[model samples]
Target: MKQGGDLLSLVGYQLQQANLRLETDARAVLADFDLTPAKLTALILIRDNPGCDQTTLGRALSINRSSAMKLVNILVEKRLIERQPGRDLRTNALVLLPEGQRQVDAMLAAVHRSDTRMTARLSREDIQTLHNLLTRLGPATGAAED
Candidate 1:
């Protein structure tokens, strides 16, 4: 394939292109569960960190408080997650419901399959190197684990 000259050489452009492709595959995988990437990520995070409040989850996702609240509300409506009283009276602790757990477990496997298929062209070493390089390019500020 012919490279697009200077644009092809730009890291941001390359990352965007890669993200578009990965997101497309992810969307397809998530469709089976009727979820968006954000929702699935929220579910997984809630499952892993039971009793975590929306503020912490929002910070981890790099989203604002309002957006996080809206996401949480949607999940609550779907019966996928619940909000209980938090450590403070002002906050609500996020917890994944049984149905959410079941969905997340299946979704994890589907996402893994999708990722493996997408990276099939690369060897295991190549994938590892790519992951390491990407990690190095991540934010300098302490952000949530990828």
Candidate 2:
């Protein structure tokens, strides 16, 4: 029992350290693209879920509607994304432009490299174990099958 508690505490600390390192590394790569992590993430969301409305994006990103709108404004001004009127003509549907797609592809590649470097300390089996554990803890774990 004591050993299990010790292992849990140690794992918590390791996860915190890993999160901080990821934040630093992500910011460095995103800086090159003139984007913050939030912006890049919002772009990716737009790309993957075309026609998603602001409220939906806000929920997915865990950001408020205002923040989502602000990010959307930036992307629109940069010509990376555009908005279409939803069925009700009230909500705006997000769509990635060709430029947005290019940016997303580049960002994804950069993020992949960053992730590889961060996880390089782990063996392939260790990586798989970590992935499986995290998936179970994540929001979509059960929803994935639905």
Candidate 3:
């Protein structure tokens, strides 16, 4: 391929666009609730991985521990997440608040609409193939576990 070919044709470019769309749609979708993307992401992470602690959550989200803690702190301040002392007593395990769960459900609906619009031209298999290709280019879920 020629250097710096039109970005749209590049998978990286498409994924970047997809991510931007997700963020933009999500911010608007979440605006009334006054939630930021980072806060919403932490809520979703806790919802999907109920027993997750800061260290693990940070790694999963590809953020550092301090940043993750700051995000978690905001969620806690907003009462969107409940942080309980971990069994280790030195860490905090997170769970989504009821309101947070509702937010995630609503966000999922919005994100689904955005995804459908983004990939309207692709077949189900094409979507799966794209997922596989992206995974091949980066460390996937289990690979991120320390």
* Reference-based lDDT, residue 26, model 3: 65
Candidate 2 lowest-lDDT run of ten: 137-146
lDDT of 1 by residue, 1-146 (tens): 67778988899999999999998999999997888888899998999999999999999889999999999999999899999999988999999999989889999899999999999999999999999999888887686666
Q: What's the lDDT for all of these models? A: 0.92, 0.86, 0.80
State in Å the error of residue 136, model 3.
2.8
Which runs of model 3 end up more than 4 angstroms from their true locations? 1-14, 140-146
Decoy 3 TM-score against native = 0.75
Clashing pairs in 1: none
Q: TM-score of every model?
A: 0.90, 0.85, 0.75
Best by TM-score: 1
Which run of 10 residues does model 1 get worst, by summed lDDT?
Answer: 137-146
Q: What order do candidates take by TM-score, descending?
A: 1, 2, 3
Question: Candidate 3 on 14-104: residue-level lDDT in tens?
Answer: 7787788767876776686787766667778899889789899998788998998888888888887888878697888888889878878
